[model samples]
Target: DEYLERESFETSYFSTVAAAQEALDKHTAASAARDNQSVTGSSAFSEHWDILIIHMVTSKLDSHTMRDWETERNHIKSIPTLEEFNSFLKNRADLLETMEEAQSQKHTRRHSDISHNRPKTFVLIPTTRINCEALNIPSHIKLADPTFSVPAEVHMLLGADLFWAVLSNNRINLGKNKPTLVETTLGWIVSGSIQVPYSKHNKMQSYNTVHCHFLNNIELEEKLDKFFEFESVSTTQQSRTKGESECEQIFTQTTTRHPDGNFIVTIPLKESPECLGDSSQQALIQFKSLERKFNRNSEFKQKYTDFLEEYQTLGHMSENTNPQDDKTSYIMPHHGILREDKLTTKLRTVFNASSITSSGKSFNDIQYIGPTVQDDLLSILIRFRQHKYVVSSDIEKMYRQIYVKEEQRSLQQIYWRSDPSEPIKLYKLNRVAYGTASAPYLATRCLMQLGQECTDKNVGETILHDFYVDDYISGNDDEQTLIQTCQNSPTEFMGEKC
Candidate 1:
């Protein structure tokens, strides 16, 4: 009985051990099957799993959580001590200082180089007209209108004056040397026309005629010759001074330069006709022809339409509420005050009341003065209500509306120099100019003061208005109410209305 009981116990123990081993093997097989499934899913999925496993393994090895732990480990590894750290910090500070010094030196050198470069200058010449007539006469001149006659001599003098004015003006420095004369040839293609001033004898004699001919150099001639083929020269006669048969001649200059360039005389006609008829009619014809050409050019029309669409889109974008999608509008302020004294005093009073300072200086200490409380009043009024219909009015030159006071004129001094070598000269602002940091603030304050005054009067409710410098947008439910507000406002300088 004892032997049989011992055998039974041993058999039970072996069976239990075998069962445990089988369970362990099954778990291992399941894990391997799941991993194989994951690997076979997709290339991307397999790569991601590999990365995740790598990160998990890395995290377990040496987790650096705190500065003290890092320091302790460094110490164990015989890393730099406190004394070495302090030396390194000092060296780093020195390196930073050196870098800053180097940067400053580089900036100074660049600035010096820029300053040494010669300043550029440009010259502009007013265009003039030259008449081709009063020489010899030829037959078969194509006349547009019988009533019109070309002026022969007056235009040449005008052209000469223009040319001389451009040459003599020393304000424009054309590099180290002036432009040398290349070649001066008469441009026979009539550029533009002007109405001749009436003589004392008859007011009816005034008529439109070709005023000038463009004169170009050899460079321009070569450029013209590449494209244009010479056409022909023809002329006609016109009666000039009284009984003596004066022959007014004209050179019929034509070119096949479809890609237009500066005018060149193809067939030089010695004698031409003064009676080239009405230059206005010829100009109209040319304009019509141009219009037709422009209409025919599909690319140009498409581009123009595209440009207009873009412009409209931009305009709409600017008017929209979304700041990110909108275009920025620039404000340009005019200079000079229409009523300097009154405006200055009004602005000063507003500034004093608000206790506003600019650039860490009191209003009195500030050099430039602008609208103080008026802008705020305006902004509040316009923004008070949103309307379906909005119309904006602009004061032609608002800054001029403010009059500078005689007493305050001396305090409103601004100094500036175009060049470093030049002395800073004080400039008295006669008008309101933008770009002063304090100007907007002052203007807003002034608007606020104005609003208060209006509120006290109980004339009308302040409307919603937005101002970006000079540009103001006023929105109102009633157009008539807006008009009335503008009309009732006392300040009408520079034609600013409600």
Candidate 2:
């Protein structure tokens, strides 16, 4: 029994010794490969790695943990590899891992504490974005709110014609229903319904509806038309005389044009005319006056001769005779001269225009009154005094200088005859007539456009501000510069002199 036990113990000891020797040899080979100059096709070892292994037999009463061969057979006091004395530490990986876990737990707790203490925030939106598709809104609509609750007072304003409005989904729809134009006097209060979805606390009813007048649409339009009638003449002799007289007094003449974006002037006439209302009587008066003045009134004759020189019409009459209207005889509301006391008054002639012909169409209907170029008279006078030396001149027949387009001339027809025996002639005024509402607008608009086109900065600026009607007034600090502006202005703008 003792021999058997002994044999078994020997076998166990030898096997353990052999296994430890093999492990030692493998570790040595790896180290040798690292140190070698040409080991070829291997990168499995690092020269800087610090590696230590304990070669032990697990059987028997376990030996003391040791990393070196030179340690006591049962225990190791220190490592043997380094030149300096080395100490041994056990469970190194476990200590490092435990410390890392504690640090991670501490960071997580700190993050949770900060999150719990912080205040909450909210975002607000603008009124413009209530209809996202309609309005071109940018991203990042979320913004910091200045208030925790709604303001005590919020102001909402709507522009003209927008007083009657509809709001849906925080969006505003202005002038969905316009005000009723009842007559020339009472304006823009009408009845209408606005259909739309309602948003929270809308100012208007959930379904917006309004009402102003009780009259039917036709009656409303008719009554309104009477109050807003245009300048026109009649065919019957008596009506023509009465209409022309009324028309002569109706037009209100002023130099400044309002930028109404439309061309219509309201004239209210009240003074007595030099000639009677009757066209036949006026014609007789004109013919007699012209016959007597032709030999004696050289100035009158000169004007008449100059008018003829303009060749405003072919001596032959227009042949159009749709109604009682003959090509030779044109229908005009009235005839008269403007600003007779002014120096340029010699150039101003009355070329009365019929707003609506017997055919029921009106010339002023389609025309547009351009924006105002005339500044406030007080402002212009102030600007005119800006310099020491003031320069002034009158445009010669300003409206006449700008010719009426050929197609438009036919719209401006007139009546002319030398004597009772002569045929009453139909004549087309070749130029824009001063007596019409659009004349001032056309003349000033052209002049203003010309001024804008001027290249010289000073001259352009002067022309833009200096004029009122046919009158031109400007001033400059320098005499030569003023003279230069005066000289260049007329030449550059193709200005015609009286």
lDDT of each: 0.31, 0.41
Task: Report RMSD for candidate 2.
Answer: 42.6
Q: Model 2 over residues 1-498: C-alpha lDDT tens digits? A: 543454345445544554554444444434433434342333553432222222221121122222222232223233332211111221211111121111231123232210011111122212112232322222333212222122222222222133323311232223443221112122232223333335576543322223222223555455544533432111111112444334433332422232421222332222222111223333344545555665675666566656654544532224333424422233454333334477644544454443444444334433343334454455556556556798888776566565554444555555554344677565566556666656775667656655666675655655666788778887777999888777866535543320
Give lDDT tens digits, candidate 1, residues 357-468.
2222322222223223222433234343345456565443444333332222222223322233565333333222234333443344334334434443333223112444
RMSD of 1: 45.1
Q: Best candidate, lDDT-wise? A: 2
Worst 10 residues of 2 by lDDT: 112-121
Clash count per candidate: 42, 14
- lDDT (Cα) of model 2: 0.41
Q: Which number leads on TM-score?
A: 2
TM-score of each candidate? 0.20, 0.36
